[model samples]
Target: MLYFSKMDGRRWEPLQHDNQSTVAADFRLRPKRRIVPCRPRSLYHKRSITMATTPRNPRSKSGNKPAVAAPTGVIPVYDSALMQERRQRILDETRRVIEENGIESLSMRELSKRANVAQRTLYNAFGSKDRLVGLVIQETYLTQLSRMKFATAPDTMEGVIERLARVCMHFGRKRNYLKAVMDLYFAPTVHRDTITMMRELSYGNSRPWLLQLEQRREISPFLSREQIEGDMTDLAFSVMRKWAIGDIGVARMADEAVRGFLVLAAGATTGEAQARALRTLALRKRRAAGPATAVEAAGMADMAGVE
Candidate 1:
């Protein structure tokens, strides 16, 4: 007799037989096993598991829910009415300090104290002292520049001259503050943003007036709008800078600015506009020379009488 073992899927099973023929017959009587393929887990299933495990409202206490917290790292927008009033107050105080004590005397500590704000608030609002002063200049000086009108004068070249004269007068009224501002403006280490803001304010205010001149055909067709506007703006700024630096009196600044404008306009006009510009320049030159000529002639007469 012989006995054999065979695997029956889960375990081995013994076959009892009397001979080798019986053992082969027992092995053929075993049943076959079936296999089933496995399916993969899905994204939704994983998320469901995560949600089931995570605590809902982790920060909330038992029974009552906590208030939602504000998101971190968000910058605040400064355009609200309250923020605008605060900003205006800060600017007004800055202007007052600069006008009363000069720009050199201005300090963030003093300004904050005067404005009833923390020193950190000043830094947060303006980033730096240069920026604060630049804003003051823009708000005070540039605002006036933008509001200037030729109510009495027509939309002609003469109106432009009057506007320049008014600008010189305005600068003269704030000599101390403007002088300091000019020094800072021309400094080698001044912030580029400050320079850009000042330049843009000037150029922006001038553009509308220049556009009016262009529409009226007072500006030359040969020159681009940019060329005419830029030339005139540069001339006006140069004159104002001279006045600000104490290099010239307000009267002289006005005269030089008017002359420069007329000269530039003369080259940048055609037809009747060109003739008018030339005539204005010639008349100014004659007026400027008249007194000097009279003085020289009087001196010569005195010399002859003495002789």
Candidate 2:
């Protein structure tokens, strides 16, 4: 006698056994048996088979598996309003902490305590300490940049001087905090993303005005926008760095920045614009020839006004 056993529900295989095992045997050969559907022996067997064939739910209450991940390119939304509020509070506290204690003294635990948020929440929102610091610096710069109402004025060499003066005044107002931030921004070990973001912010703010100047023919058509912007940015940053490091006062920083920009612009401008740049450069040099008192320096800064 030949018998078959169910393999998976779809197929069966022949089972061989000795005569003593089953107590029966067919000595004569017979035709091969046809395959038939398997039938469960009892309700318990049927239930077991059904359970074995069914797919499992990852999020089922009876299973320990985690919930399925969101589909590709799908972002999960959370409590947006509350998260924004929390982020704002954290940023405010971060600015205060960095301003009072400097970046080197900023502790995540202390910041969390100050902001009344969990340490994990900080990491969740900003990813890392370097990122949080970058955010604070970026926010501060943007806030100051936005406050310069005169920034929207006509793009001219005078407008450029005014903008640099405004920037210097902004830095002067937040000297302690910005100095520390600038230190971190220029550090050799600073995070690449943070530095890249800082540079992009600088470039983005300047490019539009530079482009406008180019369009009006205030900037020379021979000069590429990138070259003009790059040179001006480098000069501005060098002067700002000197101010941040206490090597120069805000007045001198503004004067130097304006002078440097004018020198570069003079080379890249034509017609009346070139003449204006050279004239401004000469005036700035004459003003810087003598050592001025605090009041005089302040007056000079006021003269190179933003509006």
lDDT of 2 by residue, 1-307 (tens): 4444344333332334564454334333334457898767784465444445777565646688865655432323557898788898999999998888788788999999999999977876777787888888889888866655663343545555655666666677667676776787778887788877777776764566677767777767677888887777777777888888779987678667766776787898777778876776676567765322233244344543432
Which ten contiguous residues of candidate 1 have the minimum total lDDT? 290-299
**Tens digit of per-residue lDDT, candidate 1, span 1-307:** 3233355444334465666334434433344456776676673356444445755663445556654543322224688998877888999999888888788898999888988889977776777788888889888876666565433243456556665556665666777677766766787987888887777765653466567767777777679778887787778778878887679887677667777877887898777778877877677677763211232223323332220
Residue 102 error, candidate 1, Å:
1.9
Clashes per prediction? 0, 0
Per-prediction TM-score:
0.62, 0.65
Off by over 4 Å in 1: 1-76, 142-149, 153-155, 204-206, 216-222, 289-307
RMSD to true structure for each model, in Å: 18.8, 15.9
Q: Tell me how candidate 1 scores on lDDT.
A: 0.68
State which candidate has the highest TM-score: 2
